[model samples]
Structure formats: C-alpha cells, structure tokens
Target: MPVNWRLKLKGFGPFDTQLDWSMSAGSAKVAIYAGNGQGKSTISRLFRLVENPQIPFPSSLITTGSAKGKFSFTVGNGSADLGHVEVDSSTGVDNQLDYLFHVFNSDYVRDNLQSRSYSPSGDIEGYIVGKSNIDLSNERQSLEDVKRKGIDARSALSKELEESKQELVSLGASRVKEFQEINVDFLMNKTVKEDCYADKIEQLKAVDELPDDAQAPDKLHLDDSYLDLDQLASLLERPYSKANFAEAFLEKVRRDAEFIEAGMRIQDGDRCPFCGRRYDEESRLLISQYDSYLKDQEATVIAALKGKQAQLSRLIDDYGRLEAQMLRGSSSYGEMRRGFDDLAKVEFPVLATTADFTTVVNAVIDEIATKNEDITLCVSSEAVGRLRDALGTCQSQLRDANKLIDELAFNLGKSKSRKTTLRKDACAELGKRIRREHREAFEEIASLRSKYRLLEEELKNKEAQSKRSKKDAVARLMANLLKGVFGNRYTFSEADFSICFKGETLGKSADSVLSDGEKAALAFCFYVASTWELINEEEDKNKLFFVIDDPISSMDFNYVYSIMQVIKNLQDTFELSRTRVLLLTHNVAFFNMVMGTKTLNEAWMLDEGKVTEVKNELLAPYAAHLRAINQVANGAAPSHTTGNSIRQILETLMHFEDPSLGTLGDYLESDYGGRLNEVAYLHLICNDQSHGTRTFGYAQPPMDDSTIRRACNAVIEHIRDRYPGQLVTAGVEPSENNSSS
Candidate 1:
C-alpha cells in the first residue's frame, strides 16, 4: 500500500510554510533540503501519522483561542481514494472527513491483529524473542486438570484412612481381655525401693554443701586469735627485761660494797689531816652517814627494782592479752576441727551398703503370693499394673501399625483411582496437544508463506539498492578509468582510457582491484546486480531518482572531481538526469568541478527558503582570473619542471626566502586535485630535476631500492601467500595514503 500527504500550516512558527509532496508508490527514500532549523524534518513526521495516529499536533499550529486544529491525510491503494483522517481536539479519535479511511486487511490480519490474537509476525517475534504464546494456552489447561485430579486423589485417600483408623480403635479395645492378672504391686514396690536409693543418693550429695576449712568463720577466728600461756610467756620475753634487772641489781651490789668500804675507812682507819682524831666523835657520824648512804642506795636499788617490776608488769599484761587471744584462737580452732572431724565422719561408700537390695528391699516389698484354681491369680496388683502399662504401650503400637495400614490401603485405593483419572487426563492432554500442535502447524505454514513473501519483497528492494549502488560505482570508475593507469600530468582522452595492473587479482572483478582507484568500479557491478533484481520485481515503469547530499565529502579533490565526472557519465549513459541529479555542497571547488558551461543543465543556489539560479558566465570569470594569476605567477618563479636538470634554478630561488616557482606551482595545483596528487607530482618532478645529484632525497638515496621494495613486497607477498589466494586493492589513497576514498 502507498500513501500521500499534503500539509498546510499558518501559525506553526518555523513550519508555518506550506508544502505539497507525494511518496510515489514503492519509494522509500525521501530527500529534504534547506539549511539548519528550516523544518526540513517536519515533513517526514507527517507521513508517520498513518502508521501511528496518537501524536498530538504542535500547539503552535493551533489558531489562537481555538483549542485545536485539524490534521488530515489520505491512505489507501495506489490512488488517494482510500480515506482521510481529521484529528481535532482530543488526539486519538479518528474522524472520517469526506473520504473513508482505507484499510487493506485480509482475514488473517483481522483475526490476528487484536491484542488477544496472535499474528504470524507477532508469533514469529514471540518465537525468536522468547514470549512464546503457543504452549501457554495448553499448559494452562493441563495445569488446571492436574490440580483437580490431585485434590480428588487426596480426598479419597483421606476417607479410606479414616475408616481404617476407626476399625483399629475397635480392635485395640478387644485385645484388652487377655492379660488381666499381671502383677503390678511388686513392680510398684520395686519402684519405690529404687526411688529410696535415688533419695539416699540425693542425701549423700549434701556433703558437698559443708563449710570448707578456709571459709569456716569460727575456725578462721580461732586461727587468728588463739594462743596458750606458754606462747604468751614466749611472746613477753622478746626484750628480756628480767636479765637487765639482774644486771642492774649486781651493779647496785657493787656500789653498796664501795659505800661500805668508804664507811669502814672513815670509821676504823685513821683519817688524815683534819680527821686525825676520827676515832671518837666522827666514828658515830661516819657510821651514821654510811647508814644514810646505804639506806639511800638501797632506796635507789628498790626504785630500780620497782621500775623493773613495772616493766615486767607491762610485759606480763601484754602476755596476758596474748595468752587470752591464743586461748580464744585455740578454742576457735578446736571448734572448727571438731566440725571438720564430724564432717569427715559423713563419708559415703562408693557402692550401696546392702550387697543385695532385696533383703532390705523385700521387707518393703508387698509380694503377690496368691494362688487360685479356676482363675489363677499368679501376679500381684503391682505386676498387673506393669503388664497393663506394657499392654497399653503395645496397644499404642498396634494402633499406630493399624493407622499405617489404613493409610497404605487408602493410598493404594487412591493410586488405583488416580490411575483412571491420569488416563483421562492424559487423553485430555493429548487432545489439547493435538489441537495446539495442529494450530501451530497451520500457523507455521502460514508463517512460512508470509516469510517467503516478505523475503521476496526484501530481496527485490535489496537488489535494486545494490544495483543503484553498483551503477553509481561503475560510472565513477569509467570516468576515472584512465587516471588509474596513466600519469596525471599527461593528457589522455576516453579513447585512451585503459586500466592495467601488474599485481595479483584480489578476488574482486577487474574494475575492482585494477588500481588504487578501481574498487568502486567493482562495487558498481553489484549495484547493477541490484538493479536487475529490482527490474525483475516490478514491471511498472516508475523509476527512482537519487539526490546525493555531500556524497563526496570524504573524497579528495581529484576523487571528488572524478566522481562528478562519473555522475555526468551516468546521466548521459543511463539518462538518469531526466529524473533528477540534485548534488548539494558547500565546497566552491566541487561546484566548479561538476558545473561547467554545458555539462550541467542548471545551477541552483539555496538562499532563504528558495532556490536561485546561477549563470556559467559568473563561474567562468572566477576560474579565468584564478588561472591567469596562477600562470603569470608561475612564469615569474621557476618553471614547473619534472626534470632534476632544473635544480640550479630551485636552489637559487630558495637561497632568498622568496617562494620557489616550483613550490608555488605545487601549491596552486593542490586546489585542482588534492595534497596527495600534489605530493606525487612534487616527488616525480624532484626526482627528474635532481637526476645527477648524489642524493635526490625523493629517491632512495644510496640504499637498495630492491630491499625497501622487497620488505614491502615481501609483506604483501607473505600476506597473499598466507591467505592462499587472498589479495587486496585500494580505491583512492587519501593524502596520508589512508585509502578512505
């Protein structure tokens, strides 16, 4: 389906202008023109409205005070008769203006286009992108079936289990009649005796709670305070004042003896001088003085004794206190010792005292010593109770066993019932799988058909694209065909256009790898391939026009010119100009290269929002002036010679800092071709002019040309050999020989 849209705007700011356009049926490329911000892209968005109608019109386009304005477009078959949509106010409502909106829908599209439905394209996306819808429907159904069956199986199993449990409960009560006379009394007595031993063991544990020696308050007090009289005495003798007293007494005795001597001498022996008659009156006086002296000395001795006694008294008092403390301490120690002895007496033997707990135990035991004929009472009540407990435990075990049996029976029954249900479920699942698989198979067939159609469509478009590309590439190749092989300095015509190469074939066609400028020619062949494919697809006479926008931006000047020449050749050879050849550029040199006196039909300069025509006379004068100025300037300097025979002229001109005519000429030629060609021309000219010089500098100096060539050639040869038959070629070597062009 093809669609056409026309838009008019009044208050839309930059997009206020009106434009009328149509996307001729089957055409995908749309060329837009204008400087930055001129609304060139706005027109492209209007076409998208048919594909998606939700985008609101810009507010700028709305009339003042008018909430909205209408946006209308026609979509349908090849003609504009399909329908038109007028959107105003609310954005999404589709208002059929005068024409009905045309929608080309097949039954498949209708049934599969809804959200709940799955189209082949959507299904394919699901398959590849992993939101698969095919098995989801079936899986949901099977899950529901399985859940229902599981519930039913559980219910059946539970019912069977309940029944079995009830039966076991009844049977357990009936088994109680067999063991009625089991002795329980003896068992209880034995238990009580065991309990007594346990209590005794508990009592024995009390010894651990007895006060330790170090912690006993009384004992500690005794140790701290106790002392005997002997100890008191020893304690008191530390200074030995008694011996000192005795020594003092002896000294006093000696002093008394001295006094006696003095008295006897005064009384009995003759005193000299004034005492010559000492026998009479002085005898009594001497005796009296001696007596008084003795008495005073004795008093002194007694006083010394009394002082000694006082000292002894203090020591004795201290001793008494010490003795009292020692006795108190001893008493405390004794009390602690007694307590400890008593505690020691509380030792418990490791084993029980009675060898057999029976003798002492039997006394406590209530025996069941009874006998009867008809119903034998063999065991006591205690034994009977024990037997009853054991029976109860056994009954519990039997109950558990019965419960397990019930569960097993229930499970078996449920399993049997589930087998039938599983079969039915399996049948249902199989049916679902069949239906789903059938639908899928049908869908797969439909998808394959749709894919084949889509691929066919794509192949046609791709082929046309490839063909156009090849045609452009080939035309460029043909125009620059001669430049690839012959020297640029020499003149050559189309008749002399020959391309030859000495290198190995690089897998591409001859035009492709023939030279550094021939790969585009080979690629051009594929463009033709594409054209053929497109031609085979549509028999309609409609054709496409290509408008290149800065296509040669990456190409050097020479290449750009060569591409223009190719464009011209294509226009002439294929009659492509009848449709259109809108080559846009900002480069003056490029404009000159393509637009000549008669080569181009018309020249348009874009200004404001309109196209203005330019004349050849205007372009011609610019070229003429540039050429004349370049020539006279060349003559004034050295000649543009390729021979080294002109070196003296170069060196002389270079001697002063004035520009050499050779360098000036080279710089001028760069405007025509590019720096790459300029350098090549310079190198060749330099080589020729310096032919006899020892070193041309441009040449390989004294080194082996073969060695450098060999190293380069060897690498190339090695690469070719390593890849077996692989070879590579360049199209246009850039100024740095980067080969982008």
Candidate 2:
C-alpha cells in the first residue's frame, strides 16, 4: 500500500543524467526499457535502497567512473512522496538498514533482551512451576486486600501525627502565656502598692492645707504665705486671736498703703500709668483736692474710726468665713491617716480565698504543657523514621507478595515458551524428515529443470536441428507437466491429458512429468507452503516477508503468461496484499504479456538504484521475446520470410494469432526500419546476455563511439520526448573497434 507505480527517480542509476520515469499505481504494474549497461539493474537496487539505503554496488553496475545516483519515489497514494535520495560513491552509513536490517532479521535466533544466544528451557520450566494463570480472576481481590491495608496504616499514621502536632503547638502557646502571666503577677502588687501610697500622700497634703511659710503642698492651689497664715491662725485659735488679728491687720494695711502709694504718684498733664491715658488738669486738680481733704480729714479721726469700726465688723465676718473654710480639713483627716498607714504597713494579710491556691496544680499544668511540647518535637523529628520503618515493613511484605507474583509470571512465561518450543521442536523434527523426503522431490524437480534447461540449451547450441527439437521438447515438457497437474497416475494417450495419484506420488509429482506451468506453480507452492509450515511452529509471533525472485525464469512463454496469475493466486491465498513483492527482470515481452492479461499496480520498477518505470511484460524475458517476435511476424516480408534472420523467424513463430503478417512485414520491409525495430526490440530481451547470442551479433564489440553515440542520442531523445523530463545518460568512450560513417 505504501508503494505507487507512478513514483520514479529524476536522475539515477546507469541513466547517469536526470530522467523522469513513470509506471503504474495499484494494478497498473511497472516496466522499464533501456539499452544494456544503462543502469537497469542499478535501478532495481534502488528499492533495496528505499526499504534500505545502503546496498553495495556490484562492480558490474558501474558504467564508467561514476556510481553516484539520485532516487525519488511516491510512497503512498502519490500524495505521500519521498523525494530524492542520493548516493555518491562515498555516500553510505556503516550501519545501513538495507544491509544491516536483514542481518539483524536473519535466521539466527537471538535473545530479544540481551541480543545473545538463549534457550527456552529455563523460561519454560519457570512458567510451568509458577502456574500464574490458575486464578487470574482473583487478582482483583488480592489488590483490594493490599489497598485496604495500605489505607489503614496511612490513616492511623496521619491522625497520630496531625493531632500530636496540634497538641504540641497549643502547649507551646500556653507555656508562653503562663510565663508572661507569672512575670506580670510578680510585679503587679508592688506597682499597685506604690501607686496607692503616692495617692495617699497627696490626700494627706490636701487635709493638712500647709501654710504659705512652709513648702507648698504638692496637691494644693493656695499661695504659700496665705496657706502659712491660715495654718498659723488655725493653730493659734482662742487666746491668740489678738496677735493673729494684729499680724493679719498689719499685713493687710501695709499691702493697702503700698497699693495707695502706687496709685497716688501722678504727673501733671501726663497719662496715668494705671489707666493708660493723659490725666486732664481737672482730673489732676480733683486728685490733689482729694489728697488735701484726706490730710484735713486725718484731724477728724473719730469719724474715720467709726468707719473703721464698720470695716472691722466686715473683717471679722471674713475672718469667720476663713475659719469655717479651714475647719473643713477635719473631715478628710481619717482618710489621710488610713492612706498613710497603708503606705507604711509591712505586709497585707492573705485573703482567705487565696489559701486554696496550689503549686501542685501549676506544676501539673506546666508538666502537661512540657510533655505536649516534647511530644510534638519528638513526632516531628521521628515521624519520617517511623514511617520509613513502617514502609520498610510494608515493602518487605510486598516483596513477599512480589516474589509470589514473579514466581507465577516466570512460570507462566516458561510454560508458554515451553509449549511453543515443543511445537517448534516437533515441527523442526518433522521438517528435517520432510527435508530428507524433499531430497527426492528436489532431485526430481532439479531433473525436470535440467531437462528443460537441456532443451533450451539444445535449441540454443544446435541452431539447425534445434528448432524441431525445441518444439518437440516444448511439447514433451508440456505433456510431462500434465503428470504433475493431474497428480501422477494417468496413461498419456492423445485423448487423455488427465492423470491420477499413484503410490508415494499421490502427494508428490516426479519432475519428469511436470509441465512448465506446473513446475513454476510447484516452486511457488513450495516456498509459500514451507513458509506457512514454518510459521505454524513459530513460538514468538513475528512478521515475515517472502520474496520470490523471478519464479518463472525457467518456464516457457505460455508458462510465463501464467506467472502473473500464479502470483495473483498466491497473493490472495497468503493474504499478501500487504506482503511486498520485488520482481526483477529485463523482459519487456514477458512484462507486456502479463500486463496484457492481468492488472498489477503495486508493482514497481527499479532504474539505477531508483524506482522508475517498467512494463509488466518485461518481468519475463520470454514474454518480451514473444513481443519482438510478434512485431517482426506482423511486419515480415512474405517473399523473404523464409530467408529472414532467426530473430525475425522467432518473432514470426510467436505471432500465433496474427495471421496477416501485416504488423511484422511493416517492420521487416526496410533496412533502416528493421534496424529501428531491432533497437526497439532490444528492451524485450530478458536473457542474461552475459553469454551473448551470436545470432544477434552480440559477440561483436559494442559499436564505435559515433555509432553508439548516435544510438544513445536517439534512445535518449526518444525517452526524453516521451517522458519529457526523463533521460538516459550512458557514458560511452572510444573502443578498439573502428567507427564507420
């Protein structure tokens, strides 16, 4: 499916220059027609290059100095195209698939894993002993069991680790808070007591209301002097009233005279310092008059004494109000004393409720918290180790399980291999027996092949009488072939071509009795049948590709005509539409013959290590020769038909149905026309002219440079014109032979 007939190389093989070649796709088949030494076989090797790129060029394929080539092809459906692949003289990798893959896929059996010699015995025994297939359905149950246990362990470990961590964190935070509380508790009473005492001092100073002569009380707003007098008056109550009043009155009068003197000093026509404005003359006069009146009034002191008496009553009232204000201190005395006492006190009595406080409780809480923290640290540090240990234990258990599984798997594998080996060994033993039997079969086949070859050789060697015997041998081989076709037991009369099986020949046919078609079919069947037989015992499943190279090479034209049918039948029988077939030949006649009858498109033609175009009839030389014969027969001259060249006669003889020699005569009538026909006919000769045919003057050295050049040009130009881009480049040089114009 990956091959297409239309695929071809541009410049490849013996066609040293570029050439666009085409062929068939699917059932179209492929054909290639080219002069000898033009790299036809080189093209065949191209497939080998594609499937494999590095096929060594045989010395024979090299035309002149150059072997470098380029190949191109359409891989599948013509859409998936693999473009040109070039091979210069030096272009090749050491490890090439074309050469190495086959070496790797060779018949030698090797160990797949180690790539070394291996025997199935050990593996077979292991499989039988393990009995791995006994209860495959129960594997799910086993897996479930394993899974359940794994889950259990995982859950337990997860919960244990998670809770342990949380407990430790909580304990750590509690410990931090406890330490803070203890420190604060220790300082709380002292701080509170200090503050309480400081407050008490303030309260005591408030009650005392210390006089102004003393240092001012921190908490009092009174002036120091006023406070001092007020305190002295309080202390000097009752009998000390006169002195108190004298001191109080004297201080008051002194303060009043100072105030008056400060106010009396006034400048005439100047602003009064106290009121911030100029004193008018009238105002100044009024002030002077008042002063004089005051001086005069000083004589009338009795009147002033009466006024002073009234002021004395008001002073006494004020004195009584001050006394009342000082007396208010008596109310706060108790609070001041209590506060002072509290500050001076040594220790406060413990409240009865405090007696229940226990160090044991604190110690218990602390110990619990410490243990929790230790547990957390321990879990964090040791969890992985514990888990590892647990995992190691689990793995140990799993190892045991795996051992059981391995034992079963090994046993099963061994058993499977053993069963296959047994079958293969039996098949091999049978094949050996069969091969021995095949000795006779092969001998018979060889004999028939020899007989046919002798007939062909006789026809080739004794040219004069060869014609009669060749026809006779052809008939004889045909008759003999009927024996194989009919399976042995038959009396050959002109009437009966049928045969029946007899004796050991029931399943086998002696070579003497096989026809050309039967021989070809037999060879085909042997290869294909043997392949199937081999596949029967192939223990390990392996893909195989069967290649039949020129299966009908020894057969006649009639048999050659049937080769395509045989191939088709085999392809269908083997389901080998997928199998690759690489048919190589230079027989255009045979290729055309097959193409005339059957459609085979997957066929590919090789040209100069590249896939190019080739006709189906060319696959068999006999078929191509037949085409040439028909051409000559159809174009032969009736007058000189008997005197014509043997090649022409052969062409005439092959035109079984062309009664009118019309086509052959048209070709044989003229000299240049015959020469042209001959050139065209060369593409049909599949015979390996390694031993040239003298009748065709093949032994003569190839034409001189000019002649060969003229021929090369004609062919090259014709090919190029037909194929447009296709060309055949032949590197020819002057030889010993002289050139004639």
lDDT string, candidate 1, 117-153, tens digits: 2111111110011123232444445545555554554
Model 1 — which ten-residue stretch has the worst lDDT? 119-128
For each of the candidates, the C-alpha root-mean-square deviation to the true structure, in angstroms, is 33.5, 35.7
Q: Per-residue lDDT for 1-741 in model 2, tens only?
A: 334433334334456556565543454233344323345545555544433444464344344555454454332345654333344434542222111111111111122111321111111111111123333335444545545654554454344434423422332322333223222112222222112323333433332332223221121111212122222222212121111224454344334543544566554436666777877788787556544533442212322323333433343344344334333332222222222222223221111121122221223233323323222121121222332343344335434433433433343334433333333333323223333433444344344445555554543343332122222222243344344333344322212212223433211233455554454444443333323322321221123333334445467765565556655554455444343344444445554554555534443444333444443333444323322322233332212111122344234433543445545444344432324454543322312122245335656454333432333344333333333321111112123342332
Q: TM-score of every model?
A: 0.25, 0.28
List candidate 2 segments past 4 Å from native.
1-13, 22-38, 46-60, 70-74, 78-551, 577-584, 599-741
The TM-score of predicted model 2 comes to 0.28
Which candidate tops lDDT?
Answer: 2
